[model samples]
Target: MLERNEALKVIHERHSTRMFLETPVADEDVRAILDAANQAPSAHNQQSWRFIVLKGKYKEELADLVLSKAADFPKPSSTLLRLASRSIHSAPVIIAVANTGELIARGGDLFNIKDGSGVDFFRIMEIQSSAAAVQNLLLAATSLGLGTVWLGVLVLIKDDILKFIGEPKGEFMAVIPLGYPGQSSRGPKKKSLEAVIKYFVDE
Candidate 1:
């Protein structure tokens, strides 16, 4: 195998997976994924990210909660809602990610101010840190030939999910489902760089 440029291959191959096989992911693989997540860099090294892995009965409970919320919406609700409900039960592992939140005092010290704006900045940093960790987690899973999907829809039932996971008041970020692929495909093509990116250069 060509060792050089393999990271780019992994990045290009990783896609948001939907359907998954019933086969179980090995415990070692799960641990490796988490280890990759833990290695992500954080603002001020606070490492505010936290995770809750749901499998077996816990996965069932997640589907129940999401479905309960979906029922309140219009009939034949969003496909995303349907997918979110199905992912928990269908995937071998579902990992819930959140932020512990920056300590009020730390935030004040970081920004050198004791004000609400400082708190806001701290909150954003917390999310950024968690997001980086989650990206690492996804890439690692992809390298291991595991399919994964980042389910941000979990934020819809944030309160209920937090309570279920026993982390009341935690900033729910996302739920990631991982397993062997049963059915999945790369979604719509991404926009060209010229269409979305703006370059500012010194002239």
Candidate 2:
């Protein structure tokens, strides 16, 4: 039997890191993470993921914006927004992802259907591709011993956040805040493979 490989080890080590230390992440490590993300598969090779790395004063400014605008939202939403803002402030690096609005059919032809009637389907593919990239980024960060959390709450106020960062793109997918972890994390429970998986073989 083969031993557990480095890839599987990193995948198991990956978890949501909400708290972080004050130390800044190295630029080379950040580059490696982004490179991993860019290598993710996309539908028809659209490669629709766009990433914006935030640090220093820009990072602080974004946290402040999220906090200020969060009050305008409803109760639970406001609470979630505040949490996202706090995460941004705690991390040394934040990478924001957007869809870029470019899909399979726009730049070229689809599978013989050229009327743009199924634009919604193409949009979903773009979002899925971006999500795959984010997963790659998380795994890469874990391999480098960096802590990261995928901040989905950041998408709640996507427009203001995007405008603040001067990114004129499709839609905000997610933001990842990463740094050296300040505290340890216990892995969350997951369903067993046998419980979640099923075979669909023909008789």
Candidate 3:
């Protein structure tokens, strides 16, 4: 019970941490985070996630790619784009999460669906697993007193990112930029649990 409370405290206290300190996250912590992430369950245990951790010039090159590709998309909000560009370029390290599309594609044969129409089912499960992985990683980082922010912007340039990372069989799912904080934050405000959840039952 105490450990669970401590874990929940870390989850609730973790902030988005955009203004990260220039200092790099330690290698051991990165390894631990990845170890925790690997514990996430996957569709049929395929475990399709592959992480590309970028630093120095490599991270910068990908940042350039992200910004350039952002111009190709329809900009519904220039402010959000500017924030994303900064997030892409500023981190001491960026961990790019990719999944084996081939594994997802083979789901029909692997999961024994006759018509193959259930490929979407497996794909969705894989994506959920990927999300679980990211959550585990972020929570681990928080527990280690490190900070991270998820870069949703990278999904806009998934093709370019996969090409840059040289993962031909991979599909980009998320980018996470990480470091110690240059500035502190108190995490995002949220609606109460009652606002979002309701009991369902036969009336």
Indicate which candidate wins on lDDT.
2
Whole-model Cα lDDT of every candidate shown, in order: 0.85, 0.88, 0.79
lDDT of 1 by residue, 105-186 (tens): 4888776786566777788888899999999999999999999889887676788888888788778888898999887686
Clashes of each: 0, 0, 1
In model 2, the worst 10-residue window by lDDT is 104-113
Task: Give candidate 2's error at residue 23 in angstroms.
Answer: 1.0
lDDT, residue 176, model 2: 87
State the lDDT of candidate 2 residue by residue for 130-169, as single tens digits: 9999999999999999999888887788898778767766
Query: By TM-score, highest first, what's the ranking?
Result: 2, 1, 3
Q: Residue 132 in model 1: shift from native, Å?
A: 0.8
Comparison by lDDT, 2 against 3, better one: 2
Against the true structure, candidate 3 reaches a TM-score of: 0.89
Q: Which stretches of candidate 1 lie above 4 Å from their native place?
A: 1-4, 75-79, 103-105
